[model samples]
Target: MKRLLLIGVLGLALGGCATPKYNYQAVSQNISKPAIGSVNEAYVGDKMLTQGVFMEREAYYVPEAKKKFLLNIPKGYYLKTGEDQKGSYYQPVNAIPDGAAFVGVQSVLITRDNSFCFVDVYFNKVCNFKNIGEKRKISVANDNSFQQTLIYSGKVGSKINVGYREFSSNLARPAFNNDVEYDLNESKTIGYKGALLEVIDANNQSITYKVLRNFNKVD
Candidate 1:
């Protein structure tokens, strides 16, 4: 009798450890297409990674490696839709964007190695492209000053506030001319509201960010 009871307990424990699979049909069918003047948010924990808005053009808010990459969807391209264990997948329809192909779902991993904070991007649910791009340096200061700096103001519920100064730099691979530089002048406390968990950024020296609990609320 005791042996049977032990077996039953073991079975229950294993069942509890099993990974839960979401109903893809129900989830995908309900995904709303981006509306004009509306913002769609994606997150890593409490940090906001991408905040896409549909305006005159589809704008993507990609904050990676302490740098903000606000890219517009290329002309004649639409967002291809899919989802995975990681999160919702949005890739350019039919063709590659900016010469980079989206093989599959995308995810981000944060790692620390001695003096650098690595915001690693994973594609197709795998960490394959570790050295494919140039490593941009970001500086994290211990004190707040007049100079431009990357700052996470705070978070209220699902809204994450971030502040930064205006700056412009050349893309690692400039599409038009190698001599041309992209201007980035978003210097204000912006709030990323709804459907996000974390906001991550790094300095040239260290990582400075906040991570809320792991709550994947896909809406």
Candidate 2:
């Protein structure tokens, strides 16, 4: 009994040292046909490794020992829809947005490897990925970041969000660019050199900002 109590106390002490986490919200979605020869390969790793991650903002990291990733989120209670107080797949249990409909959120856990072992996130009816878009392998790993692989920010247009899958049953290749449901500034997004890649929704909108690299310092 004494040993158990000691272990419990240690656990509580260690938990206090851990940083408080943040919530990351998925951007809205939009669709765009890339210019005939444009290829974009960007990821969160570049910024994440350097800036670390913001608690309460959705972010993930691949554990050093494993190639998998960890999704930083609290376990949402099992609920019928986002509006239902019991639980929601559309929003958090404590907070609910109006007009959102989702079944329930299944809790996904991660190990020391920091990788997500289960691709079964899709199986959960409460997931926001109901419109299962295309799957693209983001080179979130260090080796790829060293090579300056482009990571999309998932923002397609000014008011739209284009999201993708990180965990899948099949492994994908690097440098392979897939069709995006939205433009660069719409859905998946990352920031470089204090300038954010703004999602340009109109033909008149320009994406002429330079995405400078500062990963060498972090590397």
Per-candidate Cα lDDT values, in order, are 0.25, 0.26
In order of appearance, the predictions have TM-scores of 0.17, 0.18
C-alpha lDDT (0 to 100) for residue 170 of candidate 2? 26
Candidate 2 regions off by >4 Å?
1-13, 17-24, 31-35, 39-57, 66-219
Error of 2 at 124 (Å): 28
Candidate 1 lDDT over residue span 13-97, tens digit each = 1111111122322111111122223333433222223221111212122323222132122222222233334333333231222
lDDT comparing candidate 1 with the true structure:
0.25
Q: Could you tell me the TM-score of candidate 1? A: 0.17
> What is the C-alpha lDDT profile of model 2 across 70-125, one tens digit per residue?
22223222111211222212222212112222222233222233222121223321
